[model samples]
Target: MALTGAASAPPRLAPGGVVTRADALLAALRAAAPDPARLPRDAGALLGERAALAGLRRNGRIAAGGRARLLCAADGWIAVQLARPDDVALLPAWLEVDPARFEGDPWPALAAAVRDRAAVPLVARARWMGLPAAAAGGGSAEGGAPGMDAKPPLAEARRAGDAPPSAAEARPADGAPPRVEAPPALRVTQAGTPRRRHAGPWRVLDLSSLWAGPLATHLLAGLGARVAKVESTARPDGARRGPAAFFDLLQAGKESVALDFRAPAGREQLRRLVAWADLVVESARPRALAQLGLDAEALLAEHPGLSWLSITGYGRPEPGGGWVAFGDDAAVAGGLVARDDDGAPLFCGDAIADPLAGLHAAWAALGALRAGGGRLLDVSLAGVAAEAAAGGVDPRACVVADAGGARVLCAGRSARVAEPRARRPAGRARDLGADTTALLREARA
Candidate 1:
């Protein structure tokens, strides 16, 4: 693997094909096992997992629509998500338009507002106002036309003059890039000694939502683990609100249980469920579920073989410590966005971070299980996205449009992201709480 953005060098990106981080993960998994090839390349197979579930991939590739499209600004470009009802409701304030009158697509009205504004300030305002928006750039705060096929000054300049700095001297002003030790991604503690537990059929308690955590457990389900997905009734998994098939796409086969932990009975039920599991997966922020009394430390203390997988945006520390993030924003934070000719960034794939983290999380979980499941694996969405982007597997093609004389914009074209060529496994997405009765019975039993 090539180290990108070397001293005085640009990150060398390969021409697009399948977007896969499987090699690194497979190699890592192999380090923990004698045979790793038995692990299904779901990362490769489940490439279009979302689209295939939504029946969107049957036609070909399809970009997001409505408020999800990339829009322009006077200075550069930004992606704004007004897909939520609340998000759409706030459009009147952002664009100074009447939300009541605004129907149909909201992009045009928002675009009208962004027409003459710089992206950074607008994106800042959007964030301040609690909207999902990200500015387009090659992960740069200072936006400028990108140097065609050349390294940026940060990579090219050594000190004041002379040649580019050596890798050691190329450290940023903040010293070496931080190693992300604040809240920590993965933490392990010995619970006595590694118990030589015989492995047979396994049970999993999936307390995760959206893509990453669910994907991990889903892969585990395929590997002979009986997974019971637990969601809170007060705050159900949002994926349930998405296209029915899409929700099922990633969550099929797992038993589903929804409970309100506020209730004493509900809390007891959750405790029993946790005790019944060989593994647990969740995407909650640090101390989130612990606030609800499901302290992972205490649970692991009780069941040393129970592995806890905790997923987050950044790690659990400052910056993105407690801050919320979805796949796209987190991917952008990890510098996975496609850079246009002027270095303006574009959204790459279908929330690219989710699946990559999913793949890595599953691999990590299995590796931990083999080594003795007595740890909390901190899976950061941004870190996983950075890992995937760093693989240099992002092959981009220029999206061309037939204009008057075949004209193009700064990027000279839009970005066409590549999906890994793999067949999706056969399954059906389940309805919310569909398996509640049987799972609850099994837990009680």
Candidate 2:
């Protein structure tokens, strides 16, 4: 598929070239979809929807959503995100400072503490403590070189652990010394089987929260999939706590099944739900699912027709698998930041990586389904961001300012920054666990 839109079309919908890449993916998705009309006409608009709903703006140093910041360390720059209270509580430990030193707002203290520290070590400490942080321009596309703009694969599909690693998977894309620690951008883990076309709408079990995974299934739902979203009663989708309208936009049209995985009955209900699904979309870390006895590899082995989409901050491999990351920091990890006139990196948009990954994940899932279903698709926020960055317009040339305000320029054209627009919620999103009783009863039957 083509990686970009036509030159006559607006190559960018926002400051960076992400919208351009998103447009390309959306075109491919529309072409491949059974119902092309179900997808949005301009996927670029989806990139800014979160920001528009939240009234977020592009701050050169602050993330569009205002939850993350780009700060200068002694050696280089780094991005840090404290989107949750739990993340804030760990700041003292991450910075090795006394908790008493921080009070009302933490940014001032954080900036002071990080200013004299080296970026790499601080990022390392933050990741070790589960805080989302990354050094600016540190990512390597396909394990090329740190900060190189080469394109990386959107998803890495590999055969489960039962199969041996292929030679291509064992080496870096650049033919450098072997670094098996890094996963390849994309690989065909399992050979494609004859297409196993579904007789009816595909049944999708979505066990993911937040933007990327839900957006993937939401797109699928738009394309006539029967989607059931499984949540935990104890800890439901955190999005439920945010703007209800925003939550509704992503969760609309999907039946809700809330289960407490801690309970034996709930676990069994989850397994039964999995059995009922033709495809599964989840964003949990590998270990989190393994603890629940719903390991993807084993499940794929057990169900020959199953297709699994695993979305994470990084690919499911050592080093990356264990690390913690969020959208802003993951984008930074992928070197997907826009550059200011002085060459300093700035966040391109609101959780840019999440939407990009969401688009790629949905497209990959559909491709897997078309190829007859026994596939494990591994998509990472950082990897997708890198791919967009590699294929994106030059950061320096993307934004220009006039008295009218900042405008994005691409492919010899200029356009005003587009506001995020939401499609009317497909339908009102069902309340959390609203379908639990009926779903569980059906499973029992």
Using TM-score as the measure, the top candidate is 2
**Number of the top-ranking candidate, with lDDT as the measure:** 2
Q: Report the CA-based lDDT of candidate 2 relative to the real structure.
A: 0.70
- Candidate 1: RMSD to truth: 10.8
| Model 2 alpha-carbon miss at residue 168, Å | 39
- lDDT of each candidate versus the true structure: 0.56, 0.70
Candidate 2 ranges with C-alpha deviation above 4 Å = 1-16, 138-188, 191-198, 395-412
- Misplaced by over 4 Å in model 1 are 1-20, 23-45, 55-78, 89-105, 109-131, 135-199, 241-246, 287-291, 391-425, 429-431, 434-438, 441-445
lDDT of 1 by residue, 1-445 (tens): 0111111222223212224455566445545544444345444445555654554321101122222545666655566765568877766665555676467766667677666665544544454345666544433322121222122123222222233222223122421211111122244454322443445667778999877788778777666667889988888888887776656656777787888878988888888888777778888866577666787767888876777777776654433434456766665545555543444455555566677777778887776676677767777776665555543332332233343312212234543223324344446766667887777787677
**CA RMSD of each candidate after superposition:** 10.8, 7.9
Q: Across residues 348-393, which tens digit of lDDT does each residue of candidate 2 receive?
A: 6778878888898888888787777888888888877766665434
